[model samples]
Target: MIRKLCIGGIGGVLCLLWGPSGFGLEPFAPRGELRIVDTSPLNWLSIALNVFERLIEIDIDGNLDPGLATGWRWIDDRTLEVTLRQSVVFHNGEAFDAETVRLNWEAYAGLRQPQMMGEFMNFKPGSRLEVVDPSTVRFRFPEPDGAALVKLGRLHMANRQFHEEHGWGEQQWGMLNKAGPWGTGPYRLMDGFSSSQKRSDRIVLEASRQYWAAKQSPRPQRLVFDNTLSRQEALQSINTAEGPVDLVSELRPVEAMSVAQSSFAEQATKRAALVTVFGQLNMRKAGSPWRDVRLRQAINLAVNRQELLGDIKGHGVIIPALAPEGAFGYDAAVTPYPFDPDKARQILQEAGYPDALMLELIAPEELQTQAISISMMLEQVGFTVDLQVLDAGAFQRQTRLKDVDHPPEQRTWDVALRSALDHLNFPPFLLYHDFALDGPSDWVGEEPELRRLYEEILRTVDREQQERLIRQMERHAHEQASFLYLYNPAQLYAVNKAVTFVLHATTLLPLVETSVTDAHWSVRKISGQEGASETRSAQADWNNAEQVALGEKVYVSFCAGCHGANLEGQPDWQKRLPLGNFPAPPHDETGHTWHHPDQWLFDIVKDGGQRFAPPRYRSAMPAYRDMLTDEEIWAVLAFIKSRWPSSIRAEQARVDARGQ
Candidate 1:
């Protein structure tokens, strides 16, 4: 859309002004130089992997493709038709159609995305798409689909004249610090990274070459997002300060063995890992009604997945995954909340609220591991629990105000969330429709038979009759307790292999299936450019950039008051407001802290994000264990990898491989 691909490095300061007291890595893609990191950012409308496109993208391994509707049909069962794909385009060059998919489903069923992406809009957004002209399009659907390609694979086209010329409602599009590079895919965007103002902390995509469905991953001549907050401070501001993660999604197999004891420990690669950090339980928080289902199955048996495996390291952080563990029609004989508190105090007196029932719980105090282990397993069950901890912009303005009745200690926190539907594509549309309550409160779970078995698994592409109707809606969401299908989590990234990707697994995150040949290859030319790569070379990039500038002076003492002063978070994170509850999580690399694992990122910077989210509890995250130190939790994980992605310093030397 705005082409420019020279790629010749501005005379690399005369090669660092004649050097040897020297430092290295100077490729910066095809050339105009683009230091990567953004370990996150690019929420790109629910997830098609930030560079954008939808009408089916899927990946991580689930695979799917087509994005932007290249082909579709039906004309009946209520009509489908689709078509569009005439050399797709968007980053503003405009030109993709059906009135930009009916003005992005009339701005995703309007009310201006009140609680974000209109409950991740699984299509039918005020239904329509019609056009039947400019590259066709028809979709009708008053009903009777048989699940038209999983509801046109939860349709997504966007750019309806650029969200009606950027009027973006859903609370000014969840207060973005940046994003409008808009999709056509393959990649676009060039001038934005903290240009000092005009609100751009970072952004720089490249690879389009008139993209329509370009493949073989080859795109990267540049990508830099930089946004940063802490995946070890974006790998200590790109070691010597460069960026764009090669791999590093959410580390945790014992923090990938302290990056395999640093010095890029041969880019730690015990089987090239990726994806999984699981947790979710929006049980539709009917204000504070202890989410009834017998106090949500007595807070899922006061959880103790082996007390989070001595604080997370990888391989089955407790096994159990009632559903989400690797999500895909899941069904291991289900167990909504096993581990019993004497049947969780006999289901808290069969829901009559027995022995003591006072509740209040909210999380994301920046995920101190599910808000300090479910606030200590909801204070070991008997109830009377209270832990609010807001910050991600007042917990996304109290989950877009799904106030749900209120009362039990004046509402606002009852069952709490953990949902990890992980950008679902029919895992009961994020397992049991966000944990049902009744209907229309965004995030999900108002259950009209889990939204009619998510419209009977979207009328049916018949993947075994949509896995026998999503195993009868995950066994009616575990006999109507709604959600707690925990332990399907695992997404611990920590690569230092310099860069490579086909990075399979699918809860989203593929980086257009990454790759690289010369940003200075060696490590035997990156194990001969990929014949089984993972490769590394770091040696602790200058002691992780001086312990991430001494963990940004303890991240300006207690993380710039709820993650900001350049972390660009909170403010309205996603808008849960009124009194607040869950939105603030954008510590650059978008979030999940470079996916996590320097011992759960040094116990969440010495224990805070409500100490790894716990027992449906409260938190605004504070616990730096009497204020930081394990070398100040590896210098705030080297200031969260100085904000991530120079192939995550070669995915930290090919997953800390340290020769094997």
Candidate 2:
């Protein structure tokens, strides 16, 4: 009998017990424990350490794989249907069902300051993710979202009964001295802590027999997270053998290099730990000095990226950026800030600022990269940088605060460094955060045309239309100079030989797939040992990198003004050719980069993008071929690729196959 089921996915989501609850939790929890120095309840926004995952998990490729929601599909373009596994239970043995789903959203939705809501739609209690049945539910969006399934990864649904039974506040989840707020993950909570102003602490998860995912492979033997949240301590902990801490959140290239060369007991580099480090200037006030493009340019030119990179890291690191130049394209945009104090002086003078102005620079205390040096460099250009270092909680509070009076102009944060976790997907909804939407000042906010275009973006599901709209927004954002778009960072994490964890650009590490053992080495490291060809190919060519660095400087000296960063082509890479071919393909793996063999790759770096293309192309991608040696070109490419993920190389390979 074919039963036509009209199921709504988000509503159908459920968690319940599958197997009999007999021997409590078995010995199948994750033993591959790692330590993050700080895991604060307040750290909810910047980092949560993936406390729990729902049915659909976000994969390394930025795709959503089946998680708590074993299977999901679209009911209609405007709605989504999800089916939950029948036998899953929460950590506290509460039956996972439609009620649990409803409650989790209800709690999170009610909170005035939502940590997860901004990622997707601003979820409201009345925002209706209605339950359909015990095992089936539907997420009725206002419009279609193909990425709806993946979006579930961001939602760590909790046990409705457990949370309501307990309540929140000083007795809240992950508090100063306890671990509550249980979910249906592989591990059940044994104990926990909360977010604070000082140092961070850890939480322990015991194997859960009631957990639905545990039925698949009985979970891990044990899972322990020493959520320290301090990078320095995490780096130290990984060196110890079977200590309190095991894994660290972020390590710069220099740190990675230190691990690579150190005689530490256990160490490994978790791939793709990169993140974009950008300069976000608050452009709310109209007559405010930063509204000037010349001032923005001067601010950009004042900081030397090379020096900043050197300060950030020396090895296992890349300076040029990889993603987000145009979110959809393979554009490895490399915009180097020349160390020209004279030029900066001239530009500032020309902009009517003979002396640098006074401004407040807002940043988190932990970020130590060449990225933040932009503030110091701006000081050289005559700007007084009144540095305001705030804890994560205070920052989030102010950023989200609306009605409060920002004390005079002196107390407000003038510029900050921030990133959009999933900017490519939900664009216009977050425009207010950047553009002057609801502030006392009349800064850059949504205009009539922009709002209309954003509406079209929300309703228009056609992939092409979406891309055009995103590009339009990107163009608008760039022209507004709301942000300096410093550099999209490449993520990195060092692991001991004890565990294997997958990395994702969209989210942090997926601890569910990770496994820890006393194994001496992985097949990955064993195969790519020092003498092997794989190692040779993977071997970083820094001398060549040095050459590329030199050549890039030469290119920047002559080009960059028109060509854009590392030949990103221009702000308008889309509106390129009448012939349907771009004037300049991105230097990223997408552009015609993979089109040439190693020989031509060498030539173009030395020659320039202009030498080979026909007259009609008129590309601004100036020829570095004349300026650089063959090794330098390869080295420069190597530097750029260092920031790009392994997935891009595979795409480039396929591009090579097409012979375009």
Candidate 3:
């Protein structure tokens, strides 16, 4: 019939026959279309995990898994060779290969792209990719970097055409444009929707029929992410039989409770180990009492983390350090500071603050309750607390030295309550962004020991060695009371009972792995497990006996004078010589030579210590760049590495493979 039907109309009219459900629309089906409530219109979480693909994927337990690339190996300590998966094509019918990777890398290499983990997601400067063939590519770094694969895991791959049209990252609504959101994932951002319309309230995605993995086809034919609905409204929608919403993330405790009691919906919870809420003391502030170790310890002792968790109704674990449990380099031996107000007062007295000590504390506006609780605790410990809360934007600006309007010397806050996400589960990554000398924060001022330890950690890649170094750093931070260790927050999600969802420890919702049961539309159930995948080890270049023998001959001929014939150096090599430079260090297990990757060792030998040494740093070591060829330099390093114990050799090899 040619009759026009106006459905909740402002201006548009539809010419269609009315259906039983009304307006010719079918009833909401969880299996056919999945509606998720998101607070942000960008929907970055879904875009990163579902709409696009990376070179590698990290599982729930922080294990690296294959994604676009099938397998990888370390060509050298600074070069990673990856083999791309064949027969994979993008959503726009573009083939995925080495050229596709190169294009994506070129688009995002040096740009400070906005990411969930901040600017650390960008590849280090001077990092480049080389196409070995159509199916193979190699990544070459300026230096030996241990977090190469972890960084690659965050590189979202789009087709070459998409890169040319929209560029990389969220730049002035570029990613949200209607032209394309072309990717090589199970789903693709549905077109025909204007960027302005999508930015205002909603985004739509559809399952890709031509996705690479046929068996892992997306269950939902259509997916809608709407930000117009509030969490409360989303909860209400889920409780109804034919409501629009099927899933909601980041629910508050009260909302989770409501979902738990609802018959039509259920609540899913997991410990978000990657995100942490902690307090940073402004010990570097000029003439601040927090500079005193005793005062800092007193502050740590005053706060009751368990009580804070209880008050907030949080079901997360209290951490002893910034790093969470199960994360790489996390030490189980370290324990949280006990809550002792009396001890805190005593320490305050010992630190020459016998009377009430006045201090200023600042935190984000969202954490007002936490800030009040901490202030109360400090008040009980004979401290006069001046609590000032700022909005998220202002709080971020004040916390970062570069963004703050005031100069470093003019900063007046004594303590800042901050939150950080160690999404990679790697402590060194966090250290580089927050605690290093060149970091955004001024909390670690003139701390040579901490800076040195961080530098050493950056150069190391062996799991065991990195753990030892990180543990030492943790212990140092703990003993020094560098921060107010807090609990890891638990993330809660509300879901319609028809969907079977699994939660990851990293707080990533695996929508691709989710499924809907048509028979049980109101029966609630949740299940998940954590496991690590086996990683392949790289073959050591020093394994050849001929290379080792040749290396020994070269080492004795050119290096015997100062380094000793048996790989031993002069006594007291750790101490500086009279000329202000240290003597040659031993290459055996007793020295720190094996602590570095093979590339680092080769560079130090080939270019000599003088060129690589710090400014004005005296060095007795001579350059072999003119005397020795590249092969000779490599052979010498191989020979030196071959003399180490099997354990040391294995550790070095592990360091080498970290690049892959």
Clashing pairs in 3: none
What is the TM-score of each predicted model, taking all chains together? 0.31, 0.59, 0.69
lDDT of 3 by residue, 241-285 (tens): 544788888666556777766777888877755667788877666
lDDT of each candidate versus the true structure: 0.50, 0.50, 0.70
Choose the strongest candidate by TM-score: 3
Location of the lowest summed lDDT over 10 successive residues in candidate 2:
534-543
Off by over 4 Å in 1: 1-131, 140-218, 221-252, 258-260, 265-299, 313-453, 456-479, 482-484, 487-490, 497-509, 513-660
Clashes of each: 146, 71, 0
lDDT of 2 by residue, 161-204 (tens): 44655534321322223343266665444444434433234454
For model 2, what is the error of residue 166's alpha carbon versus the real structure, in angstroms, after optimal superposition?
Answer: 2.6
User: TM-score-based ranking, best first?
Assistant: 3, 2, 1
Q: List the lowest-lDDT window of 10 residues for candidate 1.
A: 24-33
